[model samples]
Target chain A: MAEVNNVVEALKFMALGMGVVFLFLYILVVLVKVQAALIAKYFPENTPKIPTTPVGNTVEDENRRVAAIIAAVSEFRKNKS
Target chain B: MKLKQIFISLLFAMIALTSMSQATGQDATAPVVAEVSTEKKAYEPKTIAELATSFWQTTGINAIFDVNDGETTSEPKGHAYEREMTWFESSLGRIMMILIVFLLFYLAIAKNFEPLLLIPIAFGGLLANIPLAGMGGEHGMLGIIYNMGIANEFFPLLIFMGVGAMTDFGPLLANPKTALLGGAAQFGIFGSLVGAVMIGFDLQSASAISIIGGADGPTSIFIANRLAPDMLGAIAVAAYSYMALVPVIQPPIMRALTSKAERVIVMKTTRQVHRLEKLIFPIVVLVLSILVLPESTPLIGAFAFGNFAKESGVVDRLSDTMQNALINIVTIFLGLGVGSKLAADKFLVLETMGIMIIGLIAFSAGTAAGVIMAKIMNRFSKEPINPLIGAAGVSAVPMSARVVSKVGSEEKPGNVLLMHAMGPNVAGVIGSAVAAGVLLSIFK
Candidate 1:
């Protein structure tokens, strides 16, 4: 009976220890969730959606026209000279 | 004779032309200069008026002036009630300190220095420090919240329930032996307890002191609330500051104790844990703990209830609620309540500094104890467990686990100890609570 009591006492001590540890753990997870929720609620989503696929030739074509204009101006200037 | 006559005529024509040109030039220039000067002078008053208007619009100080007449008329009624802050004497110092605390909280939250609690805590600190806001003063919102929750010890427990819901026992269950490492890590708590008593703190104060070793904030608050409610402010600040500094605290102790070879020691990956095993684990652990320590029931019971909610699978909605909405609501109140404790008179003291120092000591001791225990376990065990995982035995959770992984990888490239260390890391949470329960029962 004494041995059984000692075992019971030991068990009780273990349980107490486990309980305190778990309690802290429980609070921590709750705190994290709270933070995450706050972030999700307040942070605005404003990312611009860009369609994928290259648009390359248009810029080159514009650049060629500008170059042509510049060349024509220079040619006209030379002819005047 | 003809050349002389032409020269004389040319000189007269030149003189006339020069006089006429001068008169016309002066007439044209004077009007242009006069017009420019007139336009510039006109703009000066308009710009000044615009500046005044913008100043009024931007600051809205005019609104205060507009209401000033009414406020003056009603002033006599609120004169005694409107407790004036000692703004002239303490404003500068208070504002600077508040800014520093705000930055610390921001770093802790925004940069992920324990983001779980720090962000709310930082917000609370900011709210409290606003001059004459009355949030930390008599009849203030924060003051009321603090009295209702922290001083009364309600918020900490509610937070614990949320924590329990979010935590998974799978890692700890798969490796039950790691629980012993968790137990060993708690030496810091007892060591700090002894240190606190030696430093002239009473038993209750010492219990609050020891809890800092766990590197767990809510547990510290829980113990401090019961043990030394007066010291709650100091104990909490110390507990949280140390928790944020865990990455810095654990690595040195780990390096000092273990060799490069030992640090690099890698254990095999954990086996897939069965769901049935996971479900039963919390029950068995809780039952064993409850039977052993009735005093621990509050902490243990709440934790078990949360885990039960998780594992039962039927109460998914309830678990989700606890982990999400319920916890978030409690956190705002808890943070505000806790921040209310940082009143100028209560928080700025010699005792607060002592708590901070003792907190660091407790954390260092906890890390050392964990490493030593793992070394001892390594001697007896055939499984060849890496001692680095032992450092995670402090209840800092993923931070402690990440530290172990970082240090382990530093020793050997591609060595991943994070998942393995998580076993002990999670167990450390359970271990710290058990230790807290023991102290509560013994001291209560």
Candidate 2:
């Protein structure tokens, strides 16, 4: 009976140890968060400006135009040569 | 005219000499031919007497007579040869099973059922199933690769390093309270342990069984390999399958536990993390985790080391090697090795089904626990908290975060929970690793 009780106590301690370790990790994360918040507040950098126009369409259009222009220029050079 | 005639005649003589030489060479190489005076005929047995005396009698009494001859005959070939060929006799069955695996791969890759991992996994499966390809056989290429990594637990740990390199711990550090949810979510790990033990699995088998709840493949494989290498195939398949099915498995439980309003609650944007804080974070976590749970040091240590390399900014070469070259090489070996485990004899069993079913149970329980813990925390907390982010507590990394975002946006489109969800998302990685360590220490 004493041996059984000892085993149970050991398991409990094990669980408790895990819980304590988890609590410590949680505290560390909170400390990092608080520190980051303070630093950000102290040094306020410019927010990235968002362009109003949609992204993929404009990029695709630019690429197409550039390709056409390069083709025309190459043809002109070929004719001259 | 006389000279032209002489040249033509010389050409003719040259052609005749060449033809004669070629004929002689062909005759020398030809098989010895014998002429028969009469054509040989097959013996036609019109009666029992004729059949009994025929050359067919050489096959023994079984081949001596037809059924119409009124004689019971025994087969000349023994049963041993038939028994030996029984495994190949079911060619259709083997082909069908291979087709099923191929279809699953197709669904996984083409239909985007975890394409990043499954595409390569599916290709590996197809390669292994090729008849006599010997990918799964002893001395085979895939067999050698599998033995080199999967059996030794090298591939999975290397994968963890790559995962560590890719992960940005900034979100996790930006909102620490989410770590509680990560811890709470690990109830599934214990739940699985109890369930497995109840089913008569030993401590080591139970440990492998329970890691399915971690909802992370490398962690599951690592723990499984350490605790119970015999159960590696089942545990790995369960882990990868459930990971692919996360979007399907998690939503219902997420909906059941939290109200629509709770899901829609917007979390505050995380503040910018400092460079110094980012640099010190992995070191602090590693040291603390090791001090508390020394058993978890291997996984936690490797993870922290990889992250340290990434965050330090000075070890760009080491980080790059871990992220690209090492990871790519490991992925190929791991996929083929894992596929090699899917051999017909070992994989085709009821235990495989049990592993998959229990894996789903573990995932659901983890998700539910995280949500409930979040709601409980929300009751006491001053700041607004989104319970949906709790679902990201599983260590599926960006996928779990993406699921939270998708679900949260469905309730409130403008509510961006991805960054906030990332806190618990990363924390879940640590939580599972810790749980894996606990299991390893207790079992090993």
Cα interface RMSD of each candidate: 19.3, 10.4
Instruction: Tell me the lDDT of candidate 1.
Output: 0.66
What tier of docking accuracy does candidate 1 attain? incorrect
Off by over 4 Å in 2: A1-21, A30-81, B1-97, B127-133
- State residue B429's C-alpha deviation in candidate 2, in Å: 0.5
Candidate 2: tens digits of C-alpha lDDT, residues B1-444 = 999977865554455445545546667765322121236778444443323233222322211122122211111122222211124212332454467577768768677877666656656655554543345554666667776887677788888888777677767775678887887777777666656655556555766877898898888988887887756767877888788888888888899999987887755545445666677778877887767778887777778888888888898889888877898888877877776555443455566666777777788888888889889988889777889888988888878888987898789765567777777888888898888877766655
Report model 2's TM-score to 2 decimal places. 0.71
Q: Which stretches of candidate 1 lie over 4 Å from their true place?
A: A1-81, B1-93, B109-111
Error of 2 at A1 (Å): 17
lDDT tens per residue, model 1, B255-350: 999988788675644443445555655666577676666776676677778877877888888988887888888888877777655654456656
Task: Supply every candidate's count of residue pairs whose N, Cα or C atoms clash at under 3 angstroms.
Answer: 14, 0
Top-DockQ structure, candidate number: 2
Error of 2 at B320 (Å): 3.1
Q: Tens digit of lDDT per residue, candidate 1, span A1-81?
A: 544553444445435554455454444334333433444355424222222222247675455334434533453353222
